[model samples]
Target chain A: MDDLHSPDPTEQSWGSLLRTNREEVLEKWTQTAAANLGGRMTPAEMGRDVDEIYSALVRADTGDQIDIRSAAYADLRSLLTELSRTRARQGFSPTETAVGVYALKDAVLEILEAHGDLPGYRAFARLSRIVDDLGMFMLETYATTREAVIAEQAEALLELSTPVVKLWDGIVALPLVGTLDSARTQVVMEALLQTLVDTGSEHAIIDITGVPAVDTQVAQHLLKTVQAARLLGAECIISGIRPQIAQTVVALGIEFGDIHTKASLADAILLAMRRSGLDVVKSR
Target chain B: MDRIPILRIGDVLLVSIQIDLQDQTALALQDDLSSKIVETGAKGVLIDISALEIVDSFIGRMISTTAAVSRVLDAETVVVGMQPAVAITLVELGLTLDGVRTALDVDRGLALLSSALGKAGSDVEVDDLAHE
Candidate 1:
């Protein structure tokens, strides 16, 4: 009979098991850790921490418990917070911090899973805050980026001498100042259209006098605006066609025959008055 | 993919089109928008396409159709934020938009509509004068 005290090579200590079967132990630990951290960490943080913990668990051996109770986890939390603040101060994109938070959460979860115990609720709470902060940071950064892009794009497209102003009669004048490209054309179209509806104006003067030139594309867009105005029974009078623009129009051989174009903004206002047949001229 | 949010400012309903207005989404949006316009009894509908990068033929047709339908419902339709490239592309593609009001933005579109409505009211006086 074998001696009762005989040691079996297969029944090794935790440390030896980790060393000899690192891959298998790590895999098992990762799954356990993720499960343990489930609902305790944000998705992003969990993802990050999972990788870290997996590495830590692979290094752990028999007689070694996954010690998330140590000050290391708290230090990690503080480090992440500092990193977030530092990144914010540096104006580095929040995405970077979000990525870091996710990694930390993942590592914590993995450690817990390998140990088959849960982190303290306080630790979980800290993780949650990190995730939330990162989410907000990312969202705000995205919104700012989006607004900046929109403003830049709109400025480029609209090319108006006066982008914004208020009128006493509530009739705002948006004098387009440069070439109308497809993107900017859309911005102008939308701005004018929305202005009409919002202000309930009887007339809108799109003075293109400052526009360098006109092509068939520009002409068509102008026509579309006119047609759109008529749909709402609103009249959009195109004004400010510099000689160069007129020459370009004629050169392109595009017909403004069906559309209304005025040599000047004054002409456009007069045309609008005539079209509306409003005799606003006061009698002395 | 689901319900599109339509914002109402005064008598005008501002519908911001951020997602791709294509196929089922277009049809769904049209149906939903038409019903909302009728229900809200809005005077005008402004389609804000500042977020859209592309406007296909189907979408263009839908816009025109929506405007026409809105008119029948006594609500005017205005399309705003049509990028110049989109305008050029649409024209080159031979897509015709009839009965759809357009402006540079929502504010201008509202002003134009108000002025047009005001003119319509005054036109009644003109008609009365002509009859006299």
Candidate 2:
């Protein structure tokens, strides 16, 4: 491409020009992005996202070091990280987020033409390499940050799902609502035990009214939790066993083996209270 | 030489593990504790592991074995003062130590022992008679 276009002074000339002409670059870049990748977003929002990346690119290029791992690129990485996080939360598709960087190619090309000092295809090629790298960077950042976001949300959901609410003095209720997985089972057992230790509770009612089904695997997970609780000196009452679940347990011949079973959360609560030596009396 | 000392406080046997139990020490402790249970005829056994910062499958098995042996001797075993981390590790290691009773501290463990033995004094005979 160098043979196709005229030569510029240096290899990094385009990068330097992009730095000096950031306003022009950003302005053109916004137009290109808003027109192509805006989807339901306003140009102002497009401008807000493009500006951070535009300035980052300028800083990265204008610095003495312009490599991917350079300290100069730190702001650029963080800007990409911020942009990726927001894009993910906004539910923008991955292509849309990457397009926010990719679409700048045409704008920069036009900017090069308007300046009449357009770097030769060689310089433009180098510039394209950097821009393409930045575009890919956005996608990679989006994927990584999205994974972290998912992990954090999973942890939050785990904590939320296994709430150990103290029903009475020396009685705790763990109302489980969702499909039980091994990861979630660990969280449930830990939270239940910690709560038991904290409250000195003697009984834990594991109410599974919100659980949709109970298979052999779910049964095993439940038993492991019950066994762990028993080891800690707290008896677990498996409650909310719907008629269908009861039939399934019989069909499977899975023995709960002396662990108390109840038909409803109410029954479990009553039993927990009674066993803990508390009487539920009506107040005047 | 590395036997875990078994102290008899009244009719209960208290074994506090103050050091990390090597494989040999754990085995020796298991042997010594079981014999002491039979020799002293203690109605309760309290194994306090508060000072132990770590427990592997071997250590866990030793505890389970000691509890089982104590059972044959007709004494209730209560493991007490397990640090929160140790408890979590034990669970994660898949060592529930099912036959063993657990308590938050030694005092609570002792109280549990008395009540358990009190139950054993009456209910255990019924279990024996039922078996017979």
User: What is the overall TM-score of model 2 with all chains considered together?
Assistant: 0.74
lDDT of 1 by residue, B1-132 (tens): 666788888788888888766678878888888898878888888887757668778877777787788788887777776654555456545665655667656666666566555455654653453232
Kindly report the docking quality category of candidate 1.
incorrect
Q: Going through the candidates in order, what fraction of the true interface contacts does each contain?
A: 0.00, 0.22
Which segments of model 1 are wrong by more than 4 Å? A1-258, A261-284, B114-119, B122-132
For DockQ, the strongest prediction is 2
The residue-by-residue lDDT of candidate 1 on A1-284, one tens digit each, is: 12122165223233332344345544543444345444444555444454453344333321323343344344434444454554455454555435543443444445445653222333334444544654454445545555666787767655543363333243445687777776776666667656665565656777887777788888877777655544443555567888887887888898865456778877666565554443342110
Q: TM-score each candidate.
A: 0.37, 0.74
Error of model 1, residue B113, in angstroms: 4.0
| Tens digit of per-residue lDDT, candidate 2, span A1-284 | 22212243434455655666678778888888888764578899899988877777766764334366677788888888788888887777888888888877887788667764534344566778777887788898888878888999998998788878988887888888999999998888888887877777768899988889898889988988877676666778889999999999999989988778899988888777655442111110
Tell me the lDDT of model 2 at A81: 76
Model 1 Cα displacement at B1 (Å)? 2.7
RMSD, each candidate, Å?
A: 17.4, 6.1
